[model samples]
Target chain A: MIPCAVTGIGQTRYAAKREDVSMPELVREAALRALDDAGLDFDGIDAVVMGKAPDMFEGVANPELFLAGALGAAGKPMFRVHTAGSVGGSTAIVAAHLVQSGVHKRVLTVAWEKQSESNAMWALSQKFPFQPPVAAGAGGYFAPIIRAYMRRSGAPEHIGWQVAVKDRRNALRNPLAHLHLPDIDLDMVKASPLLWDPIRYLETCPSSDGACAMVLSADVTGDRPPAWVHATAMRSEPMLFPGRDEVSPRAGAACAQELFEQAGKTPADVDCAEIYVPFSWYEPMWLENLGLAESGWRAVDAGRTALDGDLPINMSGGVLSSNPIGASGMIRFAEAARQVRGTADAHQVDRARLAMGHAYGGGSQFFATWLVGTEPPG
Target chain B: MRPVHIAGIGQIPNVRGDTDHDEVQLVQAVASAALAEAGLHKDDIGFFCSGSSDYVMGRPFSFTMAIDGVGLWPPKRESHVEMDGAWALYEAWVRLQHGDVDTALVYAYGKGHGAPVDGMLTAQLDPYYEAPLGPSPMALAALQARALIDAGRLTERDLAEVVAHARRLGATHPGVPAIDGPLDVDALLDAPYVATPLRAHDEAVRTDGATAIVLSVGGGGPRIGGIAHCIEPIELGLRDLTAATSVRRAAAWAGLEQAGSIDVAELHATYSPQAVLLRQVLGLADAVVDPSGGALVADTPFVTGLSRIAEAARAVQGGAVRALAHASGGPCLQHNLICLLEAR
Candidate 1:
């Protein structure tokens, strides 16, 4: 396999609604930024890869076809990937594969979601004929899983509140984050309304309209420093079975395990991580799943996941701070790249050399992850 | 990079409406058949990928449910594409190049008969300009057909001939619904136009179906010579509708010129005129085209593309030396993919 590196990264300012621009314009904003950051134009790109959660989110099926011109992908190999919420991370990984496989030298990948166009909750809760109806939205479905985790781990309720406050505060430093709560605190999070049992309104991710893009190349070609991709992995399993473990799903663990093994590294070598934390409790659940912490809630209670902690997680506020659904995973991946490249601005982890990005989707059945470092792999 | 081959292919008979089976069952039947043909168990498969659309199912994350058919007890490496399954095959091909996985399972399923497929396809158009106008896929294809006629590049007789030939061949394939009437060119030309310059015979037959293909590295099957795809601009006004420039570019990239003479060409031409247009663009004058009747007879959404490649591989398995398979997406062939296969 050929070596691949991320040379450019761009993100849109996430918000509940981006009414000023159309979907094409919304994606073009991030794509143009990525191209400019790479010190190249559309002519330099060899192919384009796009991803989104589902076409129903925006009432547009196969949006990549209409977006071909907007992405400057005319007369180029354009591809679209969809794997539920993990689509963004998978999109980036597919783009990297185009480079790693020696098929294309320069690849531009983008993932975006315009949630304002349609109600994602309603779209997700649709009932089909001869199938069980979805009685609850995403939060309602995951709340019981959180309850299971709390019972299994015997963790205190305060762990969820603490995560909410920490991530929101971290969002204050990220200018592009959707929610910048300077006054966020444990008390405020505890006082927030309870949308689902064991899950609070503030603990949930906000639905935002945003996009994220990256320019990957076989060789580091941009003027900026490159974050060499050490390894990438994706895994999937059935959504439900008789003995499936909803908490700490095997697919996610296997994905992360393969990722680290390929990179020849361990959790200790990872200085920071950007994980998919749609809800506050998932930060701890995923920490254990990724093998970042032997006792995930214990790590959070000990302040080990704090911004200044030994292994700072979600330094750029993560999916909790700004959730665009589809782009959230790529945001995690891009933030990890930013940390290792020393270009994370105010959210930069001090002397960060190695970082990890992780995402999961579809009842925690689909998983995608990548490990990146400052130095190229041998 | 490691060499990849089409080890096996599986497809269910196309039907207008399959009320008896759900997406999972449809996928399971074909996936099992393909794996059985490859002589491999689920444990031997290293990766899994599928192509599907949410609109066809009228639900989000529809592909998630299809994984149950593949069985994820050990949690396999998996991904999906929103486009045709042909693109999914391309992705699996690229994944094989990493040399970590030796075999991959690719499948696609669609229930187009459950909904107004032509009207649903309008959602693929530009939302700001075209979708609001509500031009059905047939309408778009008719416009392209009209442009070809105005350019003096094709006539209605030429289209009728393509449809006539496809119908005669389609009658022999069990997967296609048997045609009941005369298949003469004049008879096809006399049919009422569903859209201007395009009769019902000119459009693809919308059906519900599923398809699966197994790809392996260094396996005993038809070796993949070259595989590449390209896309054209979205705006219809900007392109010369008489020609398929993207198809020419993709063919060049796939080393079509260096592949020497082609023995068979299976094209995913959703419309009869496209088959004529592609034949002219790709310059396949001597190759046998659509030996399995192609998409015109059984144009199952998302499955037609992969079925074309499967048919091409089957042709090679039957002693053909070299073959070409083409899959297309978007209105009027805005996106095109070509896979070149040869006997090992």
Candidate 2:
């Protein structure tokens, strides 16, 4: 594979509703920032790759067709990657493949979701012929799984509230984060309404509108230090089937294993990670799935995953603080790159040499993860 | 780039509509057929990728249910694209280049007859400006046809001739629906015009179908010489209608010059005039274009472009020396893909 690096990263200030700009403008905001960070213009981009959760989210169809002009991809090769909620990370991987395959040198990849245009809850809950009418959309589907995880791991109820408080506090450090509750605390999280049993309203991610973009190039060094890509991996399984382990999906575990093996590293080598924790409990669930915690819930219970802990996760508040569905995964990826490049302002991990970004979707069946480092792998 | 070969190709015959099978069954039949033809099984597929549109199905996450067709029991490594199936194939080809996966499964399906086809296509336009107008897809194509007519690029009779030729070529392929027999240019011109300067026959015969292609490295199949794609701005006002600049750029990137003499070419010309413009842009006047009637006869929304590559691969499998396949997306040929293939 050709040596590729993340030379530039960009993201918008995520919010519940971005009524100020159209979808194109919202995406352009991030794309322009990434291009500027790369010290390049449209001329420097060889191709464009876009990713989104679903067209129904924005009442648009095949958005890339309309977005090509806004993305400065006119008369250039462009592709749209969609693999459920992992689309953002999957899109970045596809763009990186173009460079790794020696097909294109510099590729621009963007992922976004403007959830304000339409009700995603209704769209996702639109019952099919054989499917039941599940209420509350994604939270409803995942609530049962969280309960099962709690039961299986015998974790305390305060664990979920603790995560909510921790991530909300971390959001105070991130200017672009959607939720910045300065007075957030464990007591406040416990006081919040229980949207789903074992998953409080405060623990759940809020629907937001946002976009993230990155400029990936092959062996192209810019003015700033590049986040050298160490390894990237993706895995998927059927959303529903008999004998499937929904609580601790084998797909997620296999994805992490393949990623670390490809990078010639292990969980111990990771200085930090940006785990996709849309719900508070997912922090522990994914920690176990990624093999980062030997005692699973006990690891987070010991405060070992705190910002100042041995391995920091979601220092930018993560999907808990800002959940733009499609852009959420790419945000994780960009944050990891930021940590290694020492560009993450308030949330920067001191002397971080390696980091990991992760995302999962479709009933936790789809997974995409990547490892980035301050130095290129030998 | 590592050499990628089209080991197998399969597709269901295009039909106006079907009430018997769902999207999953359609995709399954073609994928199973293609894998069997390649002498491989699901276990041999190192990577899986698909292309489909949610708007076409009037639902969200359209490909999610169809994932059953590939059977992710072991949780296969996979990805997806919302564009044409040809783009999915493009991703698979790129994956094969990584050498971690020697074989890839690519599939695409579109149920064009599911909704009001013309109106559904309008949703792919710019929501802020173009979608509000509620312009049917034919009306947009009409604008392009009018420009071609005014530019003296194609006459009404020329359009009719192209359709008549496509009907004849389509007659030999069982997958293409039979049109009224032996249509002459004058007879076609006499037909009612659905859009100004574009008769009913000028538009592709709308159908619903699915296609699958298995690509592998160093296989006993048609070797992929090169594969590339390009796109243009969506706004018609910003582009010159008579020129397919994206096609020209894709052709250059796909190494049309080094492809040598083209024996068979499957061009995805949903509109008859596009066939003319693609020929002009690619300088394929002497080449045999669309031996299986092209999209003008059996166009199946997202799957049509992928079917072009399958048809071209079939030609190379039938002993053709060199073949080129083309797929176009977006309005007025705003996006284009070209694949050059040759027998090993």
TM-score of chain A of each: 0.99, 0.98
Candidate 1 scores an iRMS of: 0.7
lDDT tens readout by residue for model 1, A187-263: 99999999999899989999999999999998776688999999999999898998899998999999999998999
Error of 2 at A96 (Å): 1.0
Q: Residue A342 of candidate 2: its Cα lDDT?
A: 93
Docking class of predicted structure 1: high
- By DockQ, who's the top model here? 1
In DockQ, how does model 1 score against the reference complex?
0.90
| Candidate 2 lDDT over residue span A68-95, tens digit each | 9999999899999999989888989998
Highest TM-score against the true fold, candidate: 1
Model 2 clash count equals 0
Candidate 1 residues lying further than 4 Å off, grouped into runs, are none
Q: Write the per-residue lDDT of candidate 2 for residues B52-146, one digit (tens) a residue.
A: 88877767888988888888779789998998899999999999999888999999998886565676678889997899999877788878878
- DockQ of every predicted complex: 0.90, 0.81
